[model samples]
Target: MKMKNIKLIGIGLVGAILMIGCTDLDEELNDSVNEAAGFSASDLLAGAYSSMRELQHEQDILASYVHSSDELIAPTRGADWDDAGAWRDHHLHSWTNTHPHIDKTWRDLNSRAFNAQLVLCNGDASATEIAEATFLRTLSDFFTLDLFGVVPRRACNEDLLQPPTQQLGRAEAIDVFISEMEAVLNDMPTANGPITATQNAGRMLLAKLYLNKAVYKATGQDGVAQPGPYTFDPVDMTMAINHLNEITGYSLEDDYFSSFTPTNTETSTEIIFVSENELGGATGNIRNRWHMTMHYNQQPSGWNGFVATADLYNLFEDGDVRRSTDIPGLTDAFGYNAGFLVGQQQGPSDKTLTSLIDLEDRPGNPLVFTEEVDIFSSNERNGIRVIKYLPNLELSADADGISFSNDDAPGNDYVFFRYADARLMKAEAILRGGTDTNGESALAIINELRTSRNASMLPAVTESDILDERSRELYWEGWRRNDQIRFNTFLGTWQAKADASPERALLMPIPAEALATNPNLTQNSGY
Candidate 1:
C-alpha cells in the first residue's frame, strides 16, 4: 500500500476565526484554544470508523437485514419484543416506508457517507487516510444501494444546507462502488492484522458487489407480486471469482467457534474486516447478537428477543459439530459453544436455568427452549435461541456468576467480512460456471469447509446444497438476506412468512421520510 504525504492547510484556522468572529466570548475562547492545537486528521478518521460501527449495529439496520431473513426472527414472545408488530413485519415481508428501523438505517447510512466525505476533504489526510475515508464512504454507499435500490449522492464541496437531490440507481450504484473500490485497492493496506480498512476488505466488498450485479441489473418485474427467475450473468460470477482470488492473506479457522468468540478480535485468524469494539468503550455492539437472543434467566441475562426458526435448526445433521448444543458446565473466558441453544440450558454454576418469564402452560418447569414456536405468540421459552457469537464471559462480575449490563456494549469486534465467506463465494462462482484458476473445484472448497467444521463431505454439490451450506455457515451473521435474495429464496414460505413475490419484497421500501426530504428519491415498485 502506498501512503501519500499531505499537509494540513489553514481550514481549521479559518473555521476557528469565523466562529470567534460570529460568537460570544466563551465560544471565541474555545475557538482560540482549538486554533492553537491544530485539528487532527486521525480524529476525523476515527469518526469515519465510528460511523461504520453505528451503521452495522443500529437496531433498525440489523433488523432490516437479519430479521427479514429466514435464519433469524424476533418473534412476539408473550408480552415482549412485539414493538407494535414492527419486528414481525420484517419476517412477514410487510415492512413499509414508515418502518422505524428502515427509516433510521437510511438516515444513518446517508449521514455516514457525508461524514466520510468531510474527512476526505480535510487537507491533512495522507493517501492512507484518504483511502480509508473513501472506503467508509463507499461502504455506506454500498449499503444504501443494497437496501434501497438507490444511492444518494452528495459531494463534499456541495452545499450541506441544500438537500441532496442527486441519486444513483441500482446498476449505476454498483458501477460506482466497484470503480471506487478499484481506485483505492492499491492504496489500501493488506490485511496483516485486525485493521478495519484493508485491500482485502475492499476486495471482499468488490466481490460481493460483482456477485450481486446481475440482481441489481434485473428489470421487467415492476409491480409484480411473485418471485420469478432472474438471469445470472456469467461475467458477474467471473468478476466475483477474480476478486475473491485477490484476497489471499486470510485462511479459515479450524474451530468454527474461533471466529465468533468474545475475544475474536485478538484470537481469530479468519476475520478479514471487523468493527473493532471494547469492553468499557464504544465501537461495536457485538453484545446484541447474544443479548437479543438469550433468555432473561440465563446467566448474563439477555432481552429474550430473536430466535432461530425450527426449520433452520433442523437443517443441521445430527452430530454435526457446528450444531453442537453443549453448554459448558463452567463459563470459560470464551463463553459457550457457537450455534443454537435448545433443550435445557445451564447457568454459570451448571445449574438448570429456569425462565423468570413463565409460559401459559408450563409455568414452573425449567426454561427448556423448544424448536417448535407458535409463530403468532410464542411462550417465553418456546423458541430456540442463537448464541452464534459467544457471550462475553470475561466481563462477568464474578467467577461463579455471570453479570450483564443492558447499557454496556460487548468487547468482541463484530466481523464484517471473513475468509469463510470468500471461500463460499468462490465456490458459488465456480458452480455458476466461473473459470477456476487455483485448480480447486467447487466440491473441493465446500468439502474442505464442511470437513473442517466436523461434517461429512458431500460427493457432489448442487445449487440447493450450496444455499443450505451458506445457511449452515453464515446464519445470523447478517448475510442471510443477500444469500436468500441471490438463491431466489427470499420470498419463499417459511414458519411464519407466506410465499410472496420477490419483486414485491426483495428490496426494502425507500423510507417515507427520505422521499419527503429528497424529491429525487423514488419508492421501489411494490411500495
Candidate 2:
C-alpha cells in the first residue's frame, strides 16, 4: 500500500474520497508511473476526459443515499450501509484513506489539466483546444472547490510531489473560477450539436459555472466585507444573461415521460452533458438504477433504498408535470405491475392497501387519478424517483438487469446543463437584484418553465417563488443543496426534515480520513 497522504496525488486505495466530490483529483492520479510513460498531449487529454467521466459511477451511489427517508424505512444494519440516510459518513471517512475512485478522478482531471498546461504553457496545441482544456481544468476545479472547499490548484505536474498547498476557504472567495471560465469561453469552440462524438459540446458546463457565481459570493462573507479587495459584485448577472442567451434550440417534450422512455431520442433535447457509458460496463448508470429505484425483480426480496422525503415531494405545485417526471409515487419499472404500487406491503400479489400519496394533493393541484398511479411497497418512495435519464427503447430491454455497461444504457447524454437551468438562473438573478430588477420580464423567463407543467404562470416573481420553482424544476439534478445553501436556507427545517439539519450541513464535512492523512489540514466547522 502506498502512503496515504492527503496532499499527495491519490492513487488506488486512497482515491475514493475525491469520487464523493468528483474532483478528478483522485482519478488518473498515478503520475509517478504515468509520467515516466511519456504519453502525447492528445492521449493525456483523452485519458483525463475518461477519468472525469468516472464520477457518474460515484455520483450514482451517493445520490442513492440522499433520497432514503427516516419515516419510510427501518434503520440499516451496517457502518458502510445506506439505511441511516448518511452513507456519506462512510464516504467522508474513506475519502483519503482507501478506495481509488476519488484518486482516479482527481488524477485524471489533474493529469488532463497538467497536460493542457504543458501543451498550452509551452505553445503545443493551436490555442483552440487549449482553450477547451483550460475550461475543463477550471471546471474540474469548480467541482473540487464546490464540494471539498479548499483544494490544491496545481498548474503543472512538477507540483505533484510538493506538499498539498492550501487554497483559500470559501470565506476568502473571489469569482476566480468564474472569471477564469469566462475568459476561456470566449476563446473555445461553440457547440456544433447537443451530442459530441469528437468534441465537448454541452451548455451545462458554462451554465453551471455562472449559475453558482451568485451563491459563491453569498457564501463567503468576504463578498460583503467593507474596505476589502473582495466585495459582492452584480456583474455575474450579466454573465448569467450572456451565457444563457448563447444557448438555444432546445425545448421541453410534450410529455415529460417521453424523455425518460427507454431508447429515447428526446434526450437529444433534454440532456446536455452525458458521460459515455460503454456496453456491459459494471460501474455506470446501473448504479443509479439500482440505488435510486426499486428493482423488486432484480433484488428478489423487494426494493431496498432511496425513498423520497415528504417535504421534497410537496415542493411541487398541483398540476405541475415535473412531480411525476422527477419522482414516481410507486416502485418497479415499465412492465412489473405487481411491485409498482405506492404503499404495498409485500410483493404485488401480497399487496393489501392501495398506495396513497399526500404530497401530490393541493388546493390548486388535485390528483388526476390515472391508472398510471402506482401502488407498490408501503415504502414506495413516498416521494418521486428521478425520471430524467432512463434508458431508451434500444436499451430498455435490459433495463431490469442489476448491472449494465455504458453502451447498454440510454444514449441520452446525462444532462449536466440545458436551457431550463439557464432560464432559472436568470429568474434567480432577477429576483435577487430586487422587485424592479427585470420588471415584468423576469416572470416571462420563469413562467415559461411552468407553462409545460400546466401550472399558473407567475405574473410577477418573488425570491420565494423562484426558490419554489427551482425545487420543482431541478430537484434531483443535484442543485437542491446548492440552492438551499445559496439562499441561506440550508439549515432551516421543512415539514419532513427536522431543525437539526444546520447551515453547516450546507458545506459537507471534510472526509475525516482526509484530515487524518494530512495532519496539517483542519476539518470544516461542524464535522
The model with the greatest lDDT is 1
Q: State the lDDT at 93 in candidate 1.
A: 85
Encode model 2's per-residue lDDT on 29-69: one tens digit a residue: 45533552354445444443444444455343233223321
Model 2's TM-score against the true structure: 0.69
Candidate 1 lDDT over residue span 207-227, tens digit each: 998888777776444322224
lDDT on C-alpha atoms for all candidate structures? 0.71, 0.44
Model 1's alpha-carbon lDDT is: 0.71
Instruction: Report per-prediction Cα RMSD to one decimal.
Output: 6.2, 9.1
Q: Please provide TM-scores, in order, for all candidate models, with all chains considered together.
A: 0.86, 0.69
- Stretches of candidate 1 off by over 4 Å are 1-39, 56-58, 220-228, 325-336, 348-362, 395-407
Query: In candidate 2, where is summed lDDT lowest over 10 consecutive residues?
Result: 1-10
